[model samples]
Target: MFTKKVVVAYNDTDLSNDVLDYVHEILEMHAEIELNIVYAYEHPLENPSPFQRNYDDGAPEMLAYAEQIIQKAKNRFVDLPNHVEGFVYDTGPAAAILSHAHDHHADLIVIGNRGTRGLRELVSSVSRTIQTKSHIPVLTFPKFVQEEFEEEYHK
Candidate 1:
């Protein structure tokens, strides 16, 4: 099936870049496609410790950072003919991406699987949650898998 609208989950991480690299390959095949890049970030002080109760929430800074990253992501597609747009949300990543995809009627969701293990995995596995919960088709690119693809492509 032809994919017209795609929702991409980006957060300026290496894993997220891997997803973008894969998306670049997809763009080569689909000449007419619309990309909606979404970056969701949470406030650093959302769960501040008791000792840091008076610290500024830094929501504005975080949002600004998110916007910068989204802008950089948009720049990556600037030369391409496909339409590209970026979005920044002050919320959880998985929830924001799913909601955005649904709201925009996206045909696909492209995300990077961080492959975090142990405690970190339980605390922050956005790709897994998104894949399971999203009604739209989800494409996940793990870091190792991307590396392998690059290696093969160079050979």
Candidate 2:
């Protein structure tokens, strides 16, 4: 039996669930494994005042959103026999995930790449940054585009 300590960057977006599901299936085969699922609680850089928008209090709104997202992701691993924990960090995704992995002595980091177009592509850069900065291996699930996953699988 071997052990693996994984830090999964959790998000509940449909694409995010695809990666999370993939990880869960892998962990099921392990005799000993621990999952540290983390969600980076980030407020938009352009939005300074949540109060001015739809938030009652900016900080709490941010935290609450993070909590909800992490909770949804956690539900996916409920049946797994391995130890699973969830966390939310009010920092950039790459920085927060890397720091938590290093501090917790995680053996690997798993993140989902939401392959977006135009302005959104900037976000995928975080995965690249984490891979470069981390001493441990980072596995990123490339976002499914169109019928690529289905087409490849059917063959």
Candidate 3:
């Protein structure tokens, strides 16, 4: 029976899908609440090395990828019980999520427990930072639970 707005930190991951489905279920039960779906991105700093120019610019590609992800999410929840809004930011995922929640005065922040793993996990500073620094209430779902959540929602 929470009336506060909920913000979901979305990314192209199984956990993100779970967070979305959980938010959808919450919305179904609390029709007065609002939902915001956010995808965050951070561009790599320009390197001084000559080979740096050959590397793909992360911002534009990430933003495009985020848009596609958002579209897919929208299609998946086309008949959602509550209206959902999508947001894309070209900044660090944790920072963007925290900033957005503060700016929008969100009551809850939802995200996946982990997105990358092994070697990639070591490089994911944003998620780590969010987990440590965010002041708002945060809910994290494991990847396996996300799959079950999606199946339940789709069925």
- Report the C-alpha lDDT of model 3 over 1-155, residue by residue, as the tens digit: 65478888888676778778777777777777878888877665566467677555665777678899877776666676666788988777888899998999988888887556777766675565676778877777755755778899999
Estimate the lDDT of model 2: 0.81
For 50-141, candidate 1 gives per-residue lDDT tens digits of: 99876656767777888899999998887788888999988898999999999999999999886788888777799888988999889888
- Which whole-number lDDT from 0 to 100 does residue 3 have in model 2? 39
Worst 10 residues of 2 by lDDT: 48-57
The segments of candidate 3 whose C-alpha lies over 4 angstroms from its true place after superposition are: 44-48, 56-59, 115-128, 145-155
Backbone clash count, each prediction separately: 0, 0, 0
In terms of lDDT, which candidate is stronger, 1 or 3?
Answer: 1
Query: How would you encode candidate 2's per-residue C-alpha lDDT over 1-155 as one tens digit per residue?
Result: 33379898876777678878888888889837889889986664555475556543477778888888888888888887888888999888888999999999999898887655665565467777787889998898888676887798887
Candidate 1 — which residues are off by over 4 angstroms? 44-52, 117-123, 145-155
Instruction: Report, for every candidate in turn, its global Cα lDDT versus the true structure.
Output: 0.87, 0.81, 0.76
Q: Which ten residues in a row have the lowest lDDT in candidate 3?
A: 48-57
Each model's TM-score?
0.82, 0.78, 0.75
